[model samples]
Target: MKNTTISDLKIIQIDKIKEERGTLSVIEKDVVPFQLKRVYYLYDVPSDAYRGGHAHKELYQFLIPVSGSFDVILNDGYNTKTITLNKPDKGLLIVPGIWRELENFSSGSVCLVLASEVYDEDDYIRDFELFKTLKTT
Candidate 1:
């Protein structure tokens, strides 16, 4: 985790196929760096609400805005970055050991999360202070 920085965060462009009917986007195993183990989404969130105020120990997540848009605030315990997800054909790849906060959600926005691991409470570092302390050591 010492070498992991904000630069490790990547904006992955999903493959989009356009035809006469409509556009289709595909996300297969080759597109993502890790093998997907779980999938979920967030919807009907209030505009002022915030989510994901924690950092994962081993889980890697790929976040996609399936509908509408939202902002993802990422902190690597040293630097911070705020990225907006507005397109369905692009996704943000969040590596492990990075604190993430989801906010500024537009109306009717849907945030799709693809996880590399299953739900594990022990893998989460929920306190910012603790995360910072751990990153320094």
Candidate 2:
């Protein structure tokens, strides 16, 4: 796997079209660094609940808060950072080989995810210790 750190994370501003009624954001292939392969979302999560406690080996993910807000805690084996996503027109880009944990979800919050790969259990490093060890190699 390639070496990745917290520095690789990026906040992407989506292109929006404003109108008299509402605004529309567009996320085409140009907006993302990788080819879009899968899409998913999290909703109706309890305020005290936590999600995404694992890291991916080769998958890249873009997280967008389509409604309400939430906090994403990211780790790169040596450093940690927290980012709050509260807007529909902004997204957090997560590169491969980084640990992520989602928490502090407000009521009725929805997190939309765009992924670079399909679901593969083999690509996941669910154990933090194993992730750290793999990072050194």
Candidate 3:
């Protein structure tokens, strides 16, 4: 597996239009800076939750806050970074081999994830220590 670094993570904001009645958000394919193949939304979750404690080997994902706010903790073996996603038009792009944990979900928070590939268990590196060794050596 190729080594992944923290620089691979990218934060991007989508286009949002606000009106008197409501708002509209748009996320286009090529405009997102990455090719989107799969789309999923996370909702109906509890507060101060812990989710996504694994790392992918080949799948690249972009997390966006659609409704409310949330915090995404990313660990790339040596360093850990915390990103807050509160805007409906903003997103964080996470590459493979980086472990991610999502927490501190606000009320009625909807997180949308756009993946580069389909689900594959073989692509995951669940152990943090092993991931560190693999990245360093």
What is candidate 2's lDDT per residue for 1-137, written digit by digit as tens? 55999999999999999999999999986798999999999999999999999999899999999999999999998899999999999999999999999999999999999999999999999999999998887
lDDT of 3 by residue, 57-109 (tens): 78889898988998999988888999999988788988888989999999999
- The TM-score that candidate 3 achieves is 0.91
Which clashing pairs does model 2 show?
none
Candidate 2 versus truth, CA RMSD in Å, comes to 0.8
Measured by lDDT, the strongest candidate is 2
lDDT of 1 by residue, 1-137 (tens): 44477999999999999999999999986788999999999999999999999999899999999999999999998899999999999999999999999999999999999999999999999999999999988
Better of 1 and 2 by lDDT: 2
How does residue 79 of candidate 1 score in lDDT? 95
Model 3 segments more than 4 A misplaced:
none
TM-score of 2: 0.97
Q: What C-alpha lDDT values do all the predictions have? A: 0.95, 0.96, 0.86
Worst 10 residues of 1 by lDDT: 1-10
